[model samples]
Target: MGWLRAAVLGANDGIVSTASLVLGVAAAHGSAQSVLIAGIAGLVAGSMSMAAGEYVSVHSQADSERAELERERHELQTDVEAEHKELAAIYASRGLDPVLARQVADQLMAHDALDAHARDELGITEAFRARPLQAAAASALSFAVGSALPLLMVALTPASMLLPLVFATSLVFLAVLGALAAWAGGAPMGVGTLRITFWGALAMAITAGVGMLFGVSG
Candidate 1:
């Protein structure tokens, strides 16, 4: 679920940002080759930036989790009896009777003290820990895939129709990407899809308008 969010966001940003950049440059009377170059550059830079950012952020979270787990392990090692009692108390607070809680805690501790405390007591586990490299790779790959669509359109479309073609095609892609993201995150597909397409349209429209105005002034 966590990874899903990161991947979707990376792809969405890649698509929208690159598409918007190409449209803006094209509106400013740039040639197809120039627009394609700008789009490609934006795609590469954005993907690398997203990956590095995700890596650093996830690594920080992982480090914090490790520190917390280490602290818990040390506490368990230094004061075994106290840690056992603390675990029992946690169970008791969660509605178990004192005697039953003690028995359950003792049984769990006997099997794996650190695991027991980390899971039941502190709500920490290896499963939920962040993976920095995995997040980085996902971001990079998703961004690259998303960015390629707009670049392809710019590369193949006739110059006379480049702007309109890019706008229409990019909107379609944005809506699809949004729906996919929503589905992956267990969200309402319609709202997510519409929301993304609306923002993307607005961004391109505004940028195109500004570009045209500047071109006219010049």
Candidate 2:
């Protein structure tokens, strides 16, 4: 579930971007070969970009967490008493009585001091730890899958009807993807579908307009 949000975002971007590219090319009266080429190139580039971006972002998070843990480790070694008191104070602030807080802190430290402090004080839990590789893989795979839908439409549709067909199909695909994503996350499906469809339509429209203007001028 941790990767779900990132995967959804990656997929949505892939669909919008590749579809928009295809529609834009088609709008400019480009040949089917040209449209297919553009779509394929966009899909490959987008997937790689998503993978790299997710890896860098998640790796940064992991680095920060490691740095914080190192700092905590140094503090624990240099001033054990201060670290104990600090943990006790944290628990006390959360609602425990002062005496009970201290007792609980002592027990936690005796069991696994760093783990307890990382979880309670630093808010870095195992469940939420960043995994760069996992994030990168999820992002790339989802993007590729989403990008494929529009490219597949291009391959199947006639060149004369390419623009409208891709636009219609892409919107439907985006809506369904958004609804499924929202439903999986326990959100309102209708809202998600509408939101995605609106944005996707806007992207394609803007791109198509630009391509037409440029194509005519060029």
Candidate 3:
């Protein structure tokens, strides 16, 4: 689920930002070939950037988690009895009776002291641990895939109708991406789709207007 959110966000940003860039350039009176070239360049750059950024960020987070886990493990080893009491108290605070909490904590500590403390005290779980490489790859791949759609439209569409066609198509793609993201995250699909499309349309519109203004002035 976390990976899904990262992938979707990567893809969505790729699509919206690249589309906006291409539209702005196209409105500035560039040739279709030029626009296509720019779009492709943007896609490649954006994907690589996203991947690198995600990698670095996730790696930092993973390091932090590992450091915390190591500290907890050392604490548990140095003072097992105290750690046990701490775990029991945590459980008791969460509504368990004192005797039952102590028994449960002892049992958990016996099985895996570090795991128990990390999970209960530090709120660190294997399920939520960061994966730097996986996140980076997912971000890069998804960004490239998303960027390709608008780039393809720009390349294949007739120049006479390129702007409008690209605008409309990109909005549809953004909406689809939003709906998919929302569904994956167990959110309201319609609301997510509408929100994405609305913002995407506004960005493209603003870029196009600015481009046209620049073109006329030039």
Candidate 4:
């Protein structure tokens, strides 16, 4: 279900971005060749941007987590008793009685003090740890897949109907993606569909307006 939601979001970005690019160009009276080229450029640029951005962002997160863990390890090593009291306090605050919390904390520290502190005190679980390379690759792949749709439409549709078809088909694609996302998340599919389509339409309209305003002025 989570994967479905993620997949929907990734494809939505690709479709909306590429479709908006081509539509803006077409609306501005660009030639078919020009529009096609713009869409392809956008897909490539956007994919690389997503990849780089995700890598930097996730790498920073990983670094922060590592730094925190090192600090926690130092604290644990220097003052085991203090660390035990801190863990007990955390448990007590979470509804355990003071005596019980102390006992539990003692047992946990005896078993795996670092793991307990990392999970409870720092909120850094092994399952949720950041992987920069994996994140970057996934982001780039998703963006590329989504962006390819509008480019495919450009190849198949006549130039005369390019703008309308891109606009219309992009909306349809968004609707489908939204519905899938909603279903995966266990929300109302219609609401999700409307929400995504509305935003997608707004984005395309704004970009088209920008292109037209400048196209005429240029």
Once fitted onto the true fold, the runs of candidate 3 whose alpha carbons sit more than 4 angstroms away are none
lDDT of every predicted structure (CA atoms) = 0.89, 0.92, 0.90, 0.87
Each model's TM-score? 0.90, 0.93, 0.95, 0.88
Task: Give the range where candidate 1 is weakest over 10 consecutive residues by summed lDDT.
Answer: 1-10
TM-score of 2: 0.93
Angstrom error at residue 83, model 1:
2.6
In TM-score terms, candidate 1 sits at 0.90
Off by over 4 Å in 4: 1-10, 183-191, 215-218
Write one digit per residue (lDDT tens) for candidate 4, span 47-146: 8887787779889989999999999999999999999999999999999999999999999999999999999999999778877877777777888888
**Rank list by TM-score:** 3, 2, 1, 4
Error of 2 at 41 (Å): 0.8
